[model samples]
Target: MTTPLLMLLILTLPLLANRLVGRTAAPAATEAAAAWGLGLVFLFTASGHFVQAEAMTQMLPPWVPLRLALVHATGVLEIAIALGLFTRRWRTAAAFAAATVLIAFFPANVYAALQHAPMGGHAWGPVYLLVRAPLQLILLGWTWGFLLRGRTPKRMPSRA
Candidate 1:
């Protein structure tokens, strides 16, 4: 629900600010802005790994051991991804990697929902899964859109 909206807002904030300032920003600026925004989101989410360890652990598949350790590792990965997104050299790779991580985590979300495992005090149900599934796709598309789809703007020859 709010995830997509937040992503959209994050995606557009740079361009919106540019417009407000009577300046037209490059399209890549919007993409960069989105990258930065997503980085922050991941960082915030990573905090929950420690803050709600027991509940997060319950969402894990039984075969997985050292639940808290796994959670913390994912948090570290999220933090690394966030930092990577902030770097011009790493944004594209980071975006692609972020999408991969998001996809990898999708199964846990499904498993959690199907089990109706409540984490952070919120109950999970079919309705939540319904929204989450499509949201995953959207998140992937958004990641790809900003980083993978666009061509770099061509520079014109400068005249003397």
Candidate 2:
């Protein structure tokens, strides 16, 4: 299937399922749903890293070392992050790491746009990158807000 369609599916499937199960359309519920949705996105993208290695490597700039290896390693990281999101464990660290990962990969997106990299047989242009960049920021914010909300401080136990 095409990348855009796959992306739409990855992003919306979870949210749709959440609502179908009778979840409200409130912001908090939406954020929780998005955690699952974006987790699926990460897993899907990670699989592409391995399954479509050639296309993924094409997105990397020349300066990156061992492009193929980096692609696979990142796939592994994405899997771990996705699992963490689903389980709702390791919240602060996972959110921070996932946000950092997205920021770190922005350069590859820029390079791909500049190089006119083709994915699924269509060349990506500046307009594509323009649309994509903000999505990264939105993902970063989602990671932070959805996973890092309502911090609970450590406190000593009261004497019995």
TM-score of each: 0.79, 0.77
* lDDT tens digits by residue: candidate 1, 1-160: 5654665565556546756887546776777766776777677667778787778887788889998899889988988888988888878777777888989998888878777778632254656777777767766776777666763433457997
lDDT by residue (1-160, candidate 2, tens digit) is 2665566577778779988999888876776677787788888888888898888888887788999998899999999888877764554455666787999888888878777787542265677765677677767776666666665434458999
C-alpha lDDT of all candidate models, in order: 0.73, 0.75
- Screening candidate 2 with a backbone cut-off below 3 angstroms (N, C-alpha, C), the clashing residue pairs are none
Worst 10 residues of 2 by lDDT: 147-156
Q: Give one clash count per candidate, in the order shown.
A: 0, 0
Give the C-alpha lDDT of model 2: 0.75
State the TM-score for model 1: 0.79
Q: Which candidate is the best by TM-score?
A: 1
